[model samples]
Target: MAETLTAASSHGEHAHGEMSFWSKYVFSTDHKVVGLQYMFTGIFMGLIGGFMAYAFRMQLAFPGVEVPGYGLVSPVDYNALVTNHGTIMIFWVAMPVLVAAFGNYLIPLMVGADDMVFPRLNRLSYQVFLLSAIVLICSFFVEGGGFGGAWTAYPPLSAQSQYNLTPLGSSLWLVAVGLEFVAFLIGGINFITTAMNSRAPGMKAYDIPMIVWMIVVASIMFMASVGPLLAGAVMLFMDQNIGTAFFDPDRGGDPILWQHLFWFFGHPEVYVVLLPATGLVADIITVFSRKKLFAYRTVLYTVFATGVLSFTVWAHHQFVAGIDPRMAHVFTVTTLLISIPIAEMMFVYIATLYGGSITLTTPMLWALAFIAEFLIGGVTGVFLGASGADIYFHDTYFVLAHFHYTFFPIAIIGFYAGISFWFPKMFGKMMNETLGKIHFWGTVIPFNLIFIPLFVLGASGQHRRIYDFSHFPNLSAPWQQDLRILATSALLVMLAFQSVFLVNFVWSLWKGRKAGKNPWKSNTLEWTAESPPPHGNWSELPTVYRGPYEYGVPGRDSDYWPQNEPN
Candidate 1:
């Protein structure tokens, strides 16, 4: 430990040659190391979340079917799976992998900084996140098991402690969620401060890569949007632990207040996740397509426009939640309006690919699929955004399909795009392209198979969160059971494919082909550094002379023009 600290105390990037194993990998302050830690942990949590989904999907497909060890999953058990699945996937898996991991790895490297301005705080951010995950995992073992209240944890249900299935679990769940928020809050502050204050010499605002800019904006949006929910979490916690009636309607507290608070943050949280992905896709597609990103400044403006507009559309989620009827029209307009900027981003992606020397690399496949799939997610949302249509669709499998379409592509696929595109940069070795493409096909096909049937089930009036569809005549109609079985089977297939990715990821780090500094031949600042950059990122940070997406300029000797290449 003493030797580790001694090495860390050394100044400058090159002076860390004596770094002990602990100083170099565990408890390390290096941004790249920290990012990989977030990645691995997040992926682990994702598997847990997937298992939860599998449990509930099994129940849905074959009600009362007994397992080898555990007996038939009770309705209560099904509800718990539903609740924890949503909570863990969104909070633990998606946020950590999509935002925290890459954000930490790329912001400094791409922005031409040595590391985050607040490196220790960055370390602390991940620590708190881990602690939160532990607390959540602990909830599952508490008296009565984890809270059965849905991830939304809408109150009266969540507020009643004595009668609730997992009173202790609910309280712990709140604490876990609140801690996760705090962790990200710390990271968000570091992200914004670093981007605003720590740019290398000669790098101006416009010179900053779109990925960094989008992440910073997303961080700010998160910080701003989360305040109401943070306050709401506190109030709900008090209601659950103390004798407060903040969300208990029987005690003069409005249950609806919780919905408002949750969705206000919840809706903007979607954009908070998506914007970074939008920026990543922008960068990845440009690199693979061999073209300068079309309308780069325009895309940046669209990102800002998307963030600013996100706050206004939060009530779209509350359309059928008994809010004032007149407000629906207002929210509907805002919700529909938000799509214009999103559509602009998609159009620009297509334009960039139009006249380019496109290479359908694994990452490029993910990027292109992200655009195509996310568009479906976006278009379907318009139906739910309309107050009238949502009246029927609320809480149906349709909403489930809609969000999975949006989130699956953006969070799951988008993260893979970035991970695959930058695998060499992150670990200094190539991920096997053949396995990557195989994994891609394995994922994309089964993903569609699972969700498309879900839309059918929803359109047929199958409400979500019900434990036994056989009990309901409308839901248990002849083909409905078959549909459930099919979706569940597809889900298992999807889970099976993820194993391929897991093996490829673990095997490639040591055994894959050596990836030199710039395997992709892309023009980004991070690529200018060594693959898996050393302790301080650069012995001396490179100065940026141009924007990140300067490809295919006429008369250039090579197809790419790097940002640090002097004109």
Candidate 2:
């Protein structure tokens, strides 16, 4: 199989000869190029989302004050910024960077396939994603600015133009989101098909890398879950423009129906992004700790259980949405039950780290931080999962803080970990350790500083959606305002420090130490490929001879054993 693939790759390359710069980089069907396109585009969208966060956080900390680089933000602008920020971060940034980018680049290489099974389809996926991003950005310039009805786009406000006062923006937002979903659906098909069918000749299910399995599972979960959300988006778009009242109570439409559809996918959407990050962390931890993953099959089973249970817990988000007490209780139970498997996965990671020769490299630090920080998010989530507690905490800054704790780690920290670990293979250069560590501390510390204060403010009865708490005397206590200011100030510090990372990334690209293939001396098949692997990855595709995590084996000259290396 390896030889056959190699012959085909060589023939294709020879026939194509040298591609033009645009064909090679822009319009190429190569999985690697498409993956890089997803990555760079996601990063660019992240910057836009981050700036939106900056603008809104500034408005919250100092109401009625003119912000630098942004003028005085009105109530509508604040809502739009907050809404679009969440939308872009999740759909544009997290999905693209975590799933689309890494999945495209790593699947073929890790599985020893020549390319994605559907190469042209992969290119189409990215092109659609880029188009979705453009539509979303264009929403901001449309008549009344971007949609301000929150990222969830719950009806009456999202449905009725008079209520939200941005008919065009809302429709555009819905269309953009729907288009983004279509893009991922296309990409997900490619991920599942390639990982399942195109693995090296000798690689069995268990022999494939954990990350590849994870991405495949995530793709399946996404394809299964996103259908309802896509259908709901269509309904909402109709409600917005066609005078349809799908979610309008007065028109005999059930608003809660939208909640059911959204959360059905929304909760699972959390795990869709999360599984890949955790899988990435799994590979990273084993490599840095110099140990075989403890209970690899157990971890895989736990992930499957997590995915199955994830579907059952969606209604926990609607605990306070006037759901029946019985249904809320049921969802609460399932929600709490789902935590067990996640906890088991976390313990499995710790067991992998136990009694191993651990190296705290930059990637290792981010991996460790993901566990610690996401643990906080999970713990706080238990409170919101309960029907009783959620009644009080819903829509508070506490909820906001809990959300950031979870998603920031999943989306931001996970990206850093994967990128840091794979930087050598991705760019063929080693990032400066000092600069990496500096950026790590700069990011993680300020992250906590920003959110902890929000937790405190939320506990003090602060509502998340208020434009100005000063107008409400009870919510505007001096201490509460102080905490708000501290949170915003910390956000500023965090955003400013990101410049260090930008500098480090560009500088290391040209001036950093050379990274030959397998700089980490890891055992994955991807490590067997060249640094920044050329077109078609390798002259000869490798045959897998072992599982990915064969570290610290006895009677071996080397502690690590590459999967492609013959015994």
Candidate 3:
């Protein structure tokens, strides 16, 4: 039984239109508006990223054959697309959309802050994010058509500065990433400050919503771990601009040093992006399952464990980079050891489902899909974690299939679930459930049709990052044109299916059925307020007595439970 604190709540900043259009639109500090800005930008970037993925997948599946309605993507353009794809997916879509967007929008409400601790700093963080986006886009029109080096931007290649970075394009890529990291660092600092110091009168550490906890820990990870990469990017820029020998092997600099520095932040960057989504799914599943999270404290511990483990596993990306055998071995142990936290959380998830009467709503459906599909990603992760095994799968399409399974589920499924879970709360309207289901099945079936076989071809040793995969130099494995047909056809179907979601998403705000404050009847401060909560969020500051996952109490009137409903 959770006790909710109800203090007199007030909506501040009732002032009406005190500023000009540019001021409010471009420089305003309101988190909700800022979040919406991030949401639209992230979605736009998703379209760009998805199309790049589709364009590349087409080339891989069918060499020398251009699809109708699309021109041939040149190797340089393909390189740009790949770089942009990785960059957009990581920085623009996953981090901004998942963490920055939701963190800004929901964290304050859940923790009972009227607004961020430093609202102007919050707005400036977003402006920096926008600047980063611009720099990245500008790189495309440069003489060499953007940085040809992979998103990893490894040196010797990136450092040659003559072959690829000769023009200012590669220089711009470094600048863009530098700014983006700064954006998050600022936002991360703001998030931690707001959560720790600005909570409602009585909300304690354990009393805050799981989403808040996820973001807080993720922020901490971002702060502690991001410096190496930030410093590395600076060193990289110097290699191109001033000839600092950080990664220039020709100048007695070690290229592997870049990988070490990059993945150092790069690995934890995964959790920085995914942990918020994981927290969102945890709340959504428990609410829909009509039970408390199986082990609340363990879930928090698991989040911390995963964050710690992430820093140690960075070298898993370097097994094939000629890293020392002893270092690789140490990394392998760290990588495998990270799995225990995930496995522990997994046990908690399935355990929650054991005696629950699940409501298969759109959010819950995505959560189920997340668990089942992520198992593939997670297990394959273990396979990659093993250094001896990874030497074979390292550069192959196997890596492709594995991360797509990982990233897509978190990005698509997590955001989609957040969409489903928060739609009512977001727009005060419920999207058509029928259409959501159609979109779900549309993506689920075709998603598998495309990626599963990629694993086969990958295991048979199909190298990644090539435009003409037929030249992969592995002819012993049966190369079939069928892969082309299946993958292309599946991709098209997936695109079309997502259209239903997009359409439903847009159309529902005005046309979908109206929703009540707590439609799903979940146990969280969020449900204690109105659907599309007012600017102030709560009628009163909500105090918590139990954990966020309390649901389906036997004596409850219906199959659901509300977080703050009186015992």
If scored against the real structure, what TM-score would every candidate get? Answer: 0.96, 0.98, 0.94
Query: Candidate 2 lDDT, tens digit per residue, 15-93?
Result: 2568899989999998988999999999999999999999999988899999899899999899899999999999999
- How close is each model in CA RMSD to the real structure? 3.5, 1.3, 3.0
State candidate 1's TM-score. Answer: 0.96
Model 1 Cα lDDT, one tens digit per residue, 1-567: 223222234334534567788877777777788888888888888988988888888888888898434567887777778899889888997788878999999998888777888888888999899999999999999988998889998888887766567898999999999999999999999999989987766788888888889889989999998999999999999998898999877788998889889988998899888988888998999999899899988888999999889988877778777889888899999999999999998999999999999999999999999998999899999999888999999999999999999999977999899999999999999999999999999999999999999999999889997889888887898798998999999998998899999889989997989999999998888998898887777766677788888889899889999888989
Cα lDDT tens digits for candidate 3, 179-288: 99999999999999999988765456777778899999999999989899999999999988886898977778888988999999998988887788888888888887
Question: Where is model 2 poorest over a 10-residue stretch in terms of lDDT?
Answer: 7-16
Order by lDDT, highest first: 2, 1, 3
Give the poorly placed runs of model 1, Cα more than 4 Å off: 1-17, 68-71
Ranked by TM-score, the better of candidates 1 and 2 is 2
Taking all chains together, the TM-score of candidate 3 against the true structure is 0.94
Model 1: how far residue 423 lies from native, Å = 0.8
Task: List the candidates ranked by TM-score, beginning with the highest.
Answer: 2, 1, 3
Q: Name the candidate, 2 or 3, with the larger TM-score value.
A: 2
